[model samples]
Target: MAEFHQSRKNIIRLIFIGVFAVIAMRLFYLQVIETKYRQLANAQAIVRKLIYPTRGIIYDRHGRVVVNNTALYDLMVTPSEVKHLDTAFLCELLGIDTATFRERMEKIIIRNSRYRQSVFAELLPPDVYGRIEENLYQFPGFELVERPVRNYPYHAGAHIFGYIGEVDSATIRRSDGFYQAGDFIGKTGLERSYEDVLRGQRGVTYLVRDSRNRIQGSYAGGMYDTPAVAGKNLYLSLDIELQQLGEQLLQNKIGSIVAIDPNTGGILAMVSSPTYDPNELSGSERNKKFSRLFTNPELPLFNRPIQATYPPGSTFKPVDALIALHEGVITPQYGYDCRGVYLGCGRPIKCTESFPGHASNLYNAIAYSCNSYFSQVFRFIVDRERRPALGLAEWYRYVSDFGLGKKLGIDLPGEYSGYIPDTAHYNKIFGKGHWNSCTIVSLGIGQGEITETPLQLANVMCIIANHGYYYTPHVVDSVEGDPDFYRTHLVLHRITANVSDTDYDIVTRAMAAVVERGTATIAAIPGITICGKTGTAQNFTIINGKRVELKDHSLFAAFAPREHPKIAIAVVVENAGFGASWAAPIASLMIEKYLRDSIATDRLPLLKRISEANLIPEYILEKKRRIDSLNQVRDKLEARRIVAR
Candidate 1:
């Protein structure tokens, strides 16, 4: 019985031992047979990252950088993975308080995809990047990503340079299948205009993630990644040096300077005062800095060249003359009496000049900036029947043909359509048929609802320079890629009208008179034969419900090389008294500097004086002095009255 039991036990032991041997053999086979698969799985569990592409560069016509990329670090955080992250240390490193950190984290959690780790913050500066990157291992949830932010090489063209900010929910909704959340987009100016051409295709890489959400290895040996095609470069027609100079000229003023090539309508320089530095609104501190700028009283974000409108002043006279001449309402030989004031319009509108009973013809009238002559001519053109004025309806039509009272459809974004009051406009204000040409007669002199942007004033000058045609003003001369693109995109803008050759000659002669012997004598560029017009418009200072007189806005518009025009410019100095004093000289200097490529050193003294001069509130000064005088008189009168009583 014992021997039988031992045999059975041996058999059982053998059966159990055989089963163990079979299991071990199977395990060995599986480990060795699937070695390649196991190796791939293990490798994928370790190291993988996705890389974004670099943005393209923006250059000026001279290949100088206008907008370029600067490297910045993005602070990426994965909330769940940040188990033992040093919150205080991280906040200190990033220059953020705990409340801000918490708020940002909450926003990131809400906005990010649940399937992937989130990008909490972006565009951290180098100093912040250095601090956090050193202790990256200590924060498992956070990582550093390097990318490019837009940088302007030159500080000029602030309004035209525009800015880039992170895409919001509104932008995402209106993205039109182009962008995703958290992308930066151009908010204004040419940056907004050419966003598609400037921002290139984005590439992506497939990164494997484990259950713990740690990156593994590249999927499919990097075959799944698509290389980013870099964005195409933009070559703007801006002369950076000239643009900087223009900005310097308009410093601390509430006006603009627009310089354009009359031939090509290529904007050379567009400067508006109170401009903020482009770099100030870039990257991490963008929101804070931009908020301050946006709420600024002077309106730095306002593009005074195209967006801000003011009376064309004397600058609109040339356009008025052209329209009058084209309509054959007046002859060059036609004369008007300049008694230093206009009296026929039932109002004593005073003239700036000291002309006494001077019988001025077309040339003399323009040269002297005779208000009486223009007022007579305007009344003749609008209200006359036989050789009569064309009336407001026809007049408005002609002006609209010149691209007035409408957006010029410029390439840059945010061009404002200036207001031109017509008969209908009068109806809105004083009821239909309640007002006539006499009510709005000041429009003839570039006041009373006759407003235009600096860009429009420049365009008007270009029209006169070209004898009626102008190319639609644009900043980009050429785009990268095929030569066909440049050929197709570069377009010329010309006006189709019934302007007679004789009329153009007559207007040119009048403008020539302005430079040869007119109010614009200060604009004479030695031998440049520059034709210009000066304007001083009466503006009101309304305070405490009183309309008080203030120093007028001075304006000057000119085209250089009278015979063969190269550049057309428009300058405005706000409340700087006469156009000759402030606006004309600056316009002349810029013309000489640009056309001749060098300006006279002797003129620097004059320009430097202008640079130092301030445009203060004239009414304030006048009121203070007037009150003192009135008080003295009142005291004397009271003493006399008291003695009599």
Candidate 2:
């Protein structure tokens, strides 16, 4: 009986010790190992606030501030903490109705939990913000958070600078908790491309809150507060004055202009027509103005320089001339008798000039943009090989080397690689062994399935200007914090094509002749040697299931000073009749403006005429009129609703 009692007492003591150890471990875990419980406890008394750093400023080549930051307030609300709120007074201050306020609250609850803070009113106006700030104490859960918004002082470069908006659910999910519901992010252009470099690291500040959810002071006297790091600034290669001039010239037209510094491949100016002022997309009226711009039939949002593609027209003749010279099939003295037409195949090809000796040599052919001469040259190149397929593959390789039919890897996004049809493309259409060089002869004249972007055309000029080598074009010249990275990652390295310098000289001289006394004579600037080409691309569209031809698109590509060329440019005027009439003159004026810093006195009339020209298609105008009518009706209804409120 004594032994049994002793064993029972030992077992009871062991059970008590085990229970005590388990309790101590759980207390240690709650106090040190796990942070959720501690965070929950702190949430009751501490409010965490995010400090947004000023986005980096963007400067033009001359160090002028193009994009800067301005202060704006976002009205934030914590639904769980909102109680005893004066709904009518808040609505009055916000310029909203009671129904609108309730709708916003319900959306916030659905998009974000009731306990979390979300933006109730974004980009508040000055007067409304002032009124709410003065009476903020009356609303316990509402707070005014100051954030920086982009400001364009010059009211230009809407496409280049892009715009920022609130982060979407997809962005938040991919941000790894770095971004939340109300955070702003870049949507396009340089803003989107350099988002990481321009968006600085966010910092946090902890504040002590009273029982009534009012901030008392900084928690722990600001011991845990972190400071925000400002984003790195960007210095762009864009010449703002040149860009403004390009925009001015392209007004009332649907076209694009892209100019590049040939030596460094830096973009001097990029303009897409029908652009809006950058200021229009900022502040309290952004959403409304954006809706109007988006719904416009003209598509002002389209970035045409890199995104839109059109046939190269006669501007592509120089590339063909170079290829022919490289293959030893043509020479500077090569001549073809073109008596107004070419009857080499089943179809007769027409020539623009019917005069004698206009295409007697390679120089005159390029100067006149003779269709017969190039048609014969293309046949020579293709038939040189045993098979047509082999010859086409060779042609494709040479063309790709010029940066055609592919993206140039520009810094901006949404670049389209223009199409270049190869043997397989022809085989799929006409069947194997069914088509030959004569069937696709139109390609030699920069038409019939050959398309290129304005950017690609500009780069082609760069290749010619550099005498067979060119650099990848870029907008941002340097980053403020990391210059080495910019140089290493960007196109500091030169890319060389397979053409020889001698062939380039032959082509370059012919192009100069084009501006001197040939088709693009109007592109000539006094005291400056301009080498240019004119193109009139055939435009077509499908209407009512039938292919309808529209007015030709005017195009011109040029490089200036001829020796040690400084600027290379391309211009495309949609639905414009002839290249020399509109596109060539525009390119020349831009060149003179860049080189001479102003238009010459003799060319002022030309500049005035081109700038005042309206080339928008009639169909586009009709669609825009319909959209404008709808927008006006909606505006009237909105005004009526506001008056009723």
Candidate 3:
């Protein structure tokens, strides 16, 4: 019996030893092997704040600061660290009501856990920040964090520079853990396209907190801290002075202009009318101003240069001229009897030339902007092979080579591939083999479903200037410190119309004559040989359930100096009559300005007239008046210390 008791005691001792061994191993794991628990404990006690680096400054080609950064403060809060904070006083300091206070607090809690920090009120200007800063100590769990906000010096380049805003829920999910709520992100334009390069790396700093979660000093003597690197600077090819001039010229108008250096494909200027101060879209009043802009009749945000597609009008004649010459269907010596109309299509399509054989050859036809000459050329292009579809298919190839009906893959976003119809497309529209060249004769004159962007039209001029080749036009010149930047930006494309330089020379001479003494004589500049084409696109709009014809759009495409073209430009002024009256003259003035650095003394008066011409319709002006009056009433009511209903 004693022996049995000894064995049982031994078993009990072994069980105790096993329990202690498990405890010791767990202790070791907690202290050495597994550090997750320790890390979590440290996280609660150490407040980590992101140190945002300054965004890089944007410069024009001439080293002008187009965009720079100014310091702003973000009021951050740790919900768990709050004591008996003065809620009402805080509301007054933040210029918010009680409802806003509750809403912001609720959002903060939802975006970050009670223990983690989040933004309370952000983008406070310096004056407001200075007022609240002195009393910051009275509010616990609240800290002022400094970050950079974009400041536009000229308030120009509104659409080009874009704006920054809080990261949306969609962005957070799409970013796959890269971005978090309350993070600032680029939403459009160059900001969105170059985001990866523009958003500098975020850095972190850990601050020690007591048991009560009050800040002390840096955690671990700053061993775990990281310093943020500033974003890389961008050098754009845009000439700010020229850009501002174009913007001024297009003010109160409803169209766009695109100018490019033909040799380098550098965009010298891009202007989309009805511009707003880009500064309005930043800082404390961004939301309110954005609401006003959103409801404005004139689409200040439309980005017409790249996104708006319009009928090229007579500006498309050069492309057709080149196509006809390339197909071996016509030569520079081809002549047509045009008595201001064409009778072969069984309908009267006016050529606007009074005499027969007026378009005696390619030179005279283009010089006169003769429609009848090209109408016959169009039929030949579509009917020469006996099957009109086959001939049209060949014609489409040449036009496509001219970069119409397709996106040019510019660095900018929201570019539309202006429609170019194929034989299959024509078959769908009008039954297969049923439509002939006469059915779509308007295509020859750059109308009837053939459309192009202003940038594409500018590229047409660039193509003619180069005689057959072009680089993809771009605004970005290079990224600072990146050797591969230009390599990525400079891309060349060659268009083979199979036409010789001799053919282009003939077209150039004809265009020069058009500017000198033919259709667009108003576009001539002293000592500057300008080649230009004038076109008018008929416009219509729907009103009161009826289609009403408005004024026609004025369009012009031009290149200067004839032999060595410096600038190629396309201008379209909406609801402005006659391309010669507005678009061509605008292009000429712009060319003179670029080449001579100023308008000649004689042309200054003409420039003043163009700038003062308010093409914005009277109805739009009246609507703006009503909106402004209403806003003034609201402002007066608020000033009287009355609450808005």
Candidate 4:
């Protein structure tokens, strides 16, 4: 009995020892085998970081920096580290209020984990950095991380340079590569046009940290980290000096100024008045004041040169003349009797001319901007009986060829293809029974339901200057890092804008006559052949429940060195009556400035001092009365009030 009991106790002890050994071995296997992965996970929690690449620089043709990058710090926060942080001290240091700080924290909490970091402040200016650096320890969760912010150096072309802002949610969902939350992208202009070239490839850096979550140094001394590739520099086709002059010329006006190289179709200057500084939109405060400008009733944000559509006025007459000449509808000597009126449907269409009915040849018709001549020509077009039954159809075809009623396919964003009513379009509106050539006779003088962009108007002028051929008007000369820099990458469309040479010369001669002995005498620049046409587009507006026709929208389209045209320009001064009075002088000044280069304008001082001659005595006083009266009377009144006091 005693021997059997001892055997049972020995067996029990052996079983207990076996169980203990198995447990120890399993614990040893787990600690030794899984150590590597645990170390990696720990390292990731402390030191993983992303580095964004800097955007490319934008340069003018002269290699002058128009847009560049500046180093800025993004203040970030780790939510878990916010513990024991001084909230008021942090708010004061970062120039943010308590409510803003709380809101930002709440947003971060909702979007990110307590263990991860979130961007709390962006675009910390140098002065703000100085203040924050002084109180770094007070904000335990905050970190200053370096990033590049866009900068504009020259302030040359604000509208064309565009601006960048943080990528919106819509942009991210639509885009695929190299973009994440907190990334900036081009919002407009060339920046938006060539975002891929400007935004370079991003790089990554691996780091090591202590057990307490402090970065020690780069892992393997950054061997695994690739440096960010800098963006390719871009050289634009814009002449900075010329762009400045155009902007200066358009000051105090609510219109656009678009100048293009007639030969190359490269835009020299595209100015929209009431422009905001692009520098205003480059930084974090962008959202604060931009809404005001963008929403202004004048629509300063609108790029008027390409976006706003208005009646081309008589600037469009050249297109009619060209089409008529090309189609052989009117000969160079095709004369019309302008008894100061045009008989639309055999009803007299009134003209600005005076006298008991005079016959005007084509040359005189253009010089006089004769309504009767163009009315007859338009009737001859839409009145198929006068030509072919398809003359109106063919006229529409030529109008489309001129790029009216279509987008010119310019590089700028938000270009509008202004309305050009076709037969079908008229049918839709008038139900096919209500309209005819006489129904839209005002179109003969660039009125009626016809509409066009300033760019399209300029292109028409360019076609006239080319005498037949026109290149597609473009703003982007070339992309960055393309072959043979500085040469404008000509983007001539596959469809060549070609017209009959004989027809072109006929219109050219008529335009030359306009500057010489016709309505646009104000556009004459000595020593340079400038062919121009003036337009007075009567603008009807209702005032106090009555429809009144304001004097006109002053307009002029001209080309210089008529034999070999270099530049073609179109100027529209809104509500400034009479093209010859306001628009002609501006066009003439621009032409003189272009050809004679400041020396031509040097003659202006002598002209201004001619005491014996006041060619526009009433006009000058009437125009300046509102401008001069304000300062002169205000100054005297202020002085008198002060004396009385």
Q: How many pairs collide in each candidate, listed in order?
A: 7, 0, 0, 1
Superior by TM-score: candidate 2 or candidate 4: 2
What are the per-residue Cα lDDT tens digits for candidate 1 across 363-398?
Answer: 777877877778777777787653222388777887
Residues 1-645, model 2: lDDT tens digits: 999999999999999999999999999999999977776667668887777888889999999999999999999987766889999989988879999999999989888767667889998999999999999999977889898999999887888888988899999999988888888888998989999999898777889988777779999999999988888899998999999999999999999999999888889999998888988887888999999999998899999999999999999999999989988988899999999898887688988999999999999998998999998898888888868888988889888888999999888989999999999999999999998899889999999999999999999999889987778888998998685956664564333446778888889999999999899999988789999999999997777799989999999999998998999999999999888989999999999999989888878999889889899998889999999999999999988977777
Candidate 3 segments whose C-alpha is farther than 4 A from its true place: 1-45, 209-216, 353-358, 622-645
- Choose the strongest candidate by lDDT: 2
Q: What RMSD does model 2 have?
A: 3.8
Candidate 4: residue pairs that collide: 342-349
Give the alpha carbon lDDT tens digit for every residue of 103-159 in model 4. 988877776555456578887878888888888867766777788878877565777
Q: For candidate 3, give the lDDT of residue 290.
A: 84
Report, for every candidate in turn, its global Cα lDDT versus the true structure. 0.75, 0.90, 0.86, 0.73
- What is the alpha-carbon lDDT for the whole of candidate 4? 0.73
The superposed Cα distance between candidate 1 and the true structure at residue 302, in angstroms, equals 1.0
Model 3 scores a C-alpha lDDT of 0.86
My TM-score estimates for the predictions, one after another, are: 0.84, 0.92, 0.92, 0.84
If the candidates were sorted by their TM-score against the true structure, best first, what order would they fall in? Answer: 2, 3, 1, 4
Error of 2 at 462 (Å): 0.5
Error of 4 at 113 (Å): 4.2
Report how far residue 382 has shifted in candidate 2, in Å: 1.2
* lDDT score, candidate 1, position 515: 77
lDDT of 1: 0.75
Q: After superposition, which runs of candidate 4 have C-alpha atoms over 4 Å from their true positions? A: 1-45, 48-50, 109-117, 209-215, 346-348, 355-359, 386-389, 484-489, 493-498, 540-551, 603-645
